[model samples]
Target chain A: EPEVTQTPSHQVTQMGQEVILRCVPISNHLYFYWYRQILGQKVEFLVSFYNNEISEKSEIFDDQFSVERPDGSNFTLKIRSTKLEDSAMYFCASSEIADTQYFGPGTRLTVL
Target chain B: GESVGLHLPTLSVQEGDNSIINCAYSNSASDYFIWYKQESGKGPQFIIDIRSNMDKRQGQRVTVLLNKTVKHLSLQIAATQPGDSAVYFCAETPITDKLIFGTGTRLQVFP
Candidate 1:
């Protein structure tokens, strides 16, 4: 079955540095989302993208975070300046319309 | 303040036994619910989902039971195997498609 895929399975960056996590969503899907989970916490929604624009976002998605669909298949989440607390497993998900959202393996971001 | 939550933190089951994971939601407006399985170092994988209009839904060896009145959901796995060991989370979609996930319940299957 087709699945969402992410690049750079693991990312290590210094505090205040910019980091970009990339995802290639399932090809025919129309909606894309980004979520994060702290080491032992529940996954939290970050942002949702559709039609090349942000459709919805959560309070945790602050000024430092931005998402882009630079191409047909590539969706990216960029953090302008990372903080130690930003370290977590970032996941990308895609769905067709209102169907079940399929998740990628996730990219582990380690901010030091 | 409304959120999704699990009833248990961990559950251990013998191989070939049936396993059931329960979840509760405080949001009355939620119209959809999904169950996901997450192994170590991986993202949540879709296991099954149910809509508010349906009371029950079944997949290969999995079944999801939803109770709108009590606002509870449960995932039942038949004849659980070792590969079923993972952290399972229940997510609800209240208004928008963005999912609100619950604290996961770890399922440990042993032979």
Candidate 2:
């Protein structure tokens, strides 16, 4: 089965540094989402992208966070300046419509 | 299939036993519910899903039950094995299609 794929399985960056997490969602899917799971915490939604624009976002998705579909198949999440609390497992998901969302293995971001 | 939860609320079950996990969703507008299993170092894997219009749905060895009145959902695994051990989470999506995940319960199977 086709699955979502993410690059840089793990990322390590210092505090206040910029980080970009990349994901290639299923080719035919139209909607994409970004989620993060802190260690020992529940998965939290960040933002949703569709038609090359952000359709919805959460409070945690503040000024530092931005998502881009620079080109087809690639959905990127950029953090302008990272904080220690930003360290978590960032996941990318996609769906044909608003139905079931398929998830990627996730990229572990470690901010020190 | 043997009975589970012979001990505390640890959610540990014996291999070859059946397991039933329960969840209480928060949204009355949520018409769709999904169950996902996440193992260590990996993302959540889809198990099964049910719509509010349906009371029950089955897939392979898994079954999902939905109770709209109570705002509850449950996942049942028959003949659960050690490989079935993971953190199980229930997610709900309203009209927005944004999935809200629950606090997962760890399923640990004993040999």
Candidate 3:
């Protein structure tokens, strides 16, 4: 079965540095989303993208966070400046319609 | 104040035994519910889903039961195997497609 794929399975960055997490959702899917899981916390929604624009976002997706579908296949989440609390497992998901989002193996972001 | 949560944090079962994981969601408007399994070092994998309009839905060896009156959801696994051991999460989607996930339940299957 086709699945969502993410790059840089694991990343380590210093506080105040910039980071970009990349995802390639299923080719035919129209909607894409980003979620994060703190080490021992529930997975939290970050943002949803459709038609090259953000549909909805959470408080965690503040000024530092931005998502771009630079091309047809790539969805990128960039953090302008990272904070220690920003370290978490970031997952990308996609769906053909609006529901039943399928998730990708997450990218573990570590900030020191 | 509305959230999705599980009654148990961990469950253990023997191979070939049936396992049931239970969840309670507080959002009345949540019509879409899904169960996901996450193995170590991986993301959540979709298992099954149930809409509020239905009471139960089954797939393979898994079944999902929803009780809108009490706002409860449960996932039942038949003939549980070692590979079935993972952290299971229940998620609720109220208005939009944005999913709000619950604290996961870790399942351990012994052979």
Candidate 4:
């Protein structure tokens, strides 16, 4: 079965630095999403992308966060400046339609 | 103020037994619900899903029951095995693409 894949399984960055988490969604999927889970917390939605544009975003998806579908298969989430609280497991998910999204293994972001 | 939450934080079951994980949602507009299993260090894996139009759906060894009146959902795993040990989460969507996940329930299946 085809699955969503993410690069840099684990990332470590200094506070105030930038980090880009990359994901290659299932080839045929059109809707992509980013979610984060703090340790011992529930997963929270960040943003959703469709048609190469942001369809919706949550309050946590502030100016520091941006998502881009630079290519057909590559979808990336960039944090302009990392904060200690921003450290969490970031997951990329995609679906052929608006339902049943498939999730990637996730990228663990650690900011010190 | 919408939230999806699990009723239990952890559950233990013996192998060959059945497991039922419960979830409750405060959003009445949520029309879609999904159950996902996440092993340690891995992402959430799709187990099964049920739409509001339906009350029950089954897939493989799992069955999902949704009660819109009570705004509750449950995932039933039949004949649980040691491999079934994982954290189970129930997510809901209110006509949008983004899923609101629950706190998650850790299932421990022992042999």
After superposition, candidate 2 runs with Cα above 4 Å error: B1-9
TM-score of chain B of each: 0.99, 0.90, 0.98, 0.98
Instruction: Report the C-alpha displacement of residue A8, candidate 2, in angstroms.
Output: 0.8
What is every candidate's alpha-carbon RMSD to the true fold?
A: 0.6, 4.7, 0.6, 0.6
The TM-score values for the models, in the order shown, are 0.99, 0.95, 0.99, 0.99
Question: How would the candidate models be sorted by lDDT, starting from the highest?
Answer: 3, 1, 4, 2
Q: On a 0 to 100 scale, what is the lDDT of residue B67 in model 4?
A: 94
Please write out the lDDT profile of model 1 over residues A1-112, one tens digit for every residue: 8999998999999999999999999999999999999999999999998888999999999999999998788999999999999999999999999569999999999999
Q: lDDT by residue for model 4 over A16-44, one digit each (tens)?
A: 99999999999999999999999888889
What lDDT tens digits, residue by residue, belong to model 3 across residues B1-111? 769999999999999999999999999999899999999999999999999899999999999999999999999999999999999999999899999999999999999
Poorly placed runs, candidate 1 (over 4 Å) = none
Q: Which digits, one per residue and each the tens of the lDDT, describe model 1 over residues B1-111?
A: 769999999999999999999999999999999999999999999999999999999999999999999999999999999999999999999989999999999999999
Per-model TM-score (chain A alone)? 0.98, 0.99, 0.99, 0.99
DockQ, candidate 1, vs. native dimer: 0.89
Badly placed stretches (over 4 Å) of model 3 are none
TM-score, predicted candidate 2 vs. hidden true structure = 0.95
lDDT of each: 0.96, 0.89, 0.96, 0.96
Better of 2 and 3 by lDDT: 3
